[model samples]
Target: MNTKTIKSVRLSFLLVGMAFLLNSCFNSAKKTETTEEKAKVYPSDVIPIMEQFSILCGDGTSFKDLIKKEHKDFFYVTNDGVTDWVVYKTPNSGITSRTSSNTRTELGQTETWTPEEGGKLTGTLKVQHVSTSGDARVAASYSVVVGQIHGKEGHENEPLKIFYKKFPGHKKGSVFWNYEINTAGDDNSGRWDFSTAVWGYDMSVVGTSPDTYPAEPEEGIALGEEFSYEINVYEGIMYLTFKSKGHETKTFTKNLLKSDFSTKEAIPQQIWDLYAAIGRDGVERENAYAGEIQNFKQGAYNQTNGKNPEENIVWYTGSETYNGDIEKQYANGCYAEVWFKDASIGPGSAPNKQ
Candidate 1:
């Protein structure tokens, strides 16, 4: 071959070798960059971003703005400078998120992304319902999870799972059965005095009075010895049901508003009657004998001492007869009593005297 042609061929071969070496170096650098990028995307880094993104979206913010405003803290740029991811740390809850690009084609196209930990981003949040008047408060926690990506537009799947837990507040009072029944005359002439120390005050028979009466003790009606009482703190409703010895039943309901001792009323009728007739004499009086009046009178006197005299009286006077076969149903009386603090009563007078 000619010298000129040979020289040209040698230069071409040298240039080709240089181009191959440069290409190899470029591929190696790219591989190294990919490895570093993968390492940066750990479960910790991705979890937080996902969580913030979810919260922002749930709060009605758009995905794009959510990242900018709420997830700014968790973002990190990829080694290639073309991709980013975000992280979030939920407060008293679990983690979650959304991504700027979740599709194969768009995955690395965005300046920022979320939920790098992969799998499904999931977590929980707590919410509270606080009463404006400081009378009540309730709290609940909810859990949620993000599933697969939707279409190429990068929309996320609907929350795949959810659950909730309720937290109840402490009750603020003591409940007592405050009435007595007189089997001797089948009369329900007494009062029950219940009180609670709550809302920075004492509520009891000494404070206010609610009135209730028992239905006439029905003949052949068996008395149910056991009864149930339910108090709803939220609604402030008290429910009482009495089962007679012969299976007869009676129920009464009272609103805390009307029965609260914060008012000036005497004891509620139900409570007054209960307190009057619940003792040994009230329950076991079979014969009309001497000294009974004194006992009854003394019982009444003891009820009214110094606290609140108006709440100590039992007003029913009646009688009924039942067949001996079944524990006789004494019907003919119904009474109730409720008491509330006067708002004027100082906190010092609220303790039990006994």
Candidate 2:
């Protein structure tokens, strides 16, 4: 053979070898990229995988329910149609894997996940499908964390000390004052008391007849009578006393901490009016007016009364003694009193007549 022919043949062989090597490298790279993308984790896919574990619950048992009952402080739920477990650990604590003996096996294969101090537990569940093709399987997994609970002090059966305040206004034609009582810490059965100064002024000062007033000074002021007073509070209890000429003297003790109290953002106008009207009367009158006032405040006014002004006032009236004229005057005065009371002292301890 000629030298040039030999050289051309050698070049041709080298070019073919180079092309084959390049094609092999390209195919290998493509396969690696496909594998990496498929391996990425997805929580939704994993949770459904964990539900397979629920198969263990077939024997009249629920693994999820059991976990919730055992550790109410720690629980997990998944929306991705997958199963997950989560755990939280306190500092300096460690978790140990539960053994077969530690888990109840009556239902099926189940495990108790534990956490260590400063450690967190997480679970991710997924399912696998076996293909008809021999030895071919598709699988997925999920992640979750476990939680820990701290114990609280006091036994469940221990009695709790309740504290409250009572604001018993004066009876009609009597002085006005506020009295408090505590049923938890001090004399639970003691009556409350205050001084004449705390009782403020007598209803007689306003042209009202004291003869119609309550036998006790704790009663509120009469209609058209207005008074204010301050009651002292020491610790949780209060001591009050009063004396009148030709009348029996009395002393009362009460604790404010034992009174039941709730806080509301606003007091309705009708409630304020009803409270004022009742305050002008005695506890008996107040109790009687409660239902009527509640109905009025709830906007359930009598239709017949709405047609006639006089009937309207009477129908709205909480007391039989209050006529249309008296009700109008009482309502106007009550607006002022209610605002003053609510602003200055807040909702005082008066029983919910309702």
Candidate 3:
């Protein structure tokens, strides 16, 4: 071939080779970027137990397929400089279940079991925040439910509700649990909850006035403090264990098949004072929660609401909701946030074995 023609052919081949090399490099870089994006962690990666549960958010969002998935601002993963945690957050007021006025970003167990069948749930978590603008006179103000044994049928009363509460400007807060009565009759409005303290006062403690707060708990939990709880229902009895660093480990037990308040005289005086205004004096059934189907719940069940506290002192938390504007409420400290480092659910074991 002629020298000039051969030179032109050589240049063409060189350009073709350069284009091929550039394309290959571009594809390799894109593949590396995709690999980095997929490296982002998720709540499911932290807690593989989510496969057996469904999630409900404060905005009325619900989902069951939680494998490697997360919802923004409600159910997601976060890191606190040391550990990765799954966060559940809810505003004081948002779209909620029909039977509840308060909102929640929580997990509901898909399986149901009777008291006799039993189950167990365990969690390691921390309370990040609670609604700061609530009436101190209200029992449920500035509080959130972290765990629960909730009924699935009949009146659907909760047998256990683990709570964390702190007053505005207080450095420490209280951890308590409540047992709601399964009312005897059809009228459920008269049912009441009996509370027991875990690390501090129970649900009955409240301020004397609307804005005034009581004394801060001397040995209570502070915001961002980590704790753990195990609820084991074995052979018709409920056993609870609460533990935290720098605090005493507390354990409690209650018979689930027998009624503690079957008769009118069995109601504690705290219930009389707390529920007298609302007239909720009904007693629990003789069998209590026996034979009832129940399931476990965990995460931030926000107890603060916008209802007037004077209407119902026990549950009506007159907290600022910003008219259900979640963004405004979160920005103004009118929300609840909880973070869980680990959790698990399974069949209940014997108390001795646990």
Clashes of each: 78, 55, 0
* Best TM-score among the predictions, by candidate number: 3
Sort all candidates by lDDT, best to worst: 3, 1, 2
C-alpha TM-score for every candidate: 0.21, 0.17, 0.95
The residue ranges of model 1 lying beyond 4 angstroms of the native Cα positions read 42-354
What clash count does candidate 3 reach? 0
TM-score of 3: 0.95
- Position 67, candidate 1: lDDT: 33
Least accurate 10 contiguous residues by lDDT in model 2: 293-302
Compose the digit string of candidate 1's lDDT tens values, residues 1-354. 999999999999999999999999999999999998666553224333322222222112223322323332222222225323222211211121243211010011112212111121112111111111110110011111111112112122111111111111322211122212112343423212242211111122221122231222222211111122221111222233333243334444433223233222433453443344334222223221111110000000001101122322221111111211111221211111111110010011111220
Assess each prediction's global lDDT (C-alpha) against the native.
0.23, 0.22, 0.94
Off by over 4 Å in 3: 1-22
Give candidate 3's error at residue 347 in angstroms.
1.1
Q: By summed lDDT, which 10 consecutive residues of candidate 1 come out lowest?
A: 294-303
Predicted structure 1: clash tally:
78
Query: Which residue pairs show backbone clashes in model 3?
Result: none
lDDT digits (tens) for residues 1-354 of candidate 2? 999999999999999999999999999998899898665433223233232222111012234333222122112222333323221101101121132111111111123211111111112111111001110010000000111111111110101111011111322323322221111222322212111222333211211221122243343323223222222223333333333333344444444334321112222333234233223211111111111100000000011111122222211212211222323422332111100110011112222210
User: How does model 2 fare in lDDT?
Assistant: 0.22
Stretches of model 2 off by over 4 angstroms after superposition: 48-354
TM-score of 2: 0.17
Per-prediction CA RMSD (Å): 30.1, 29.5, 1.7
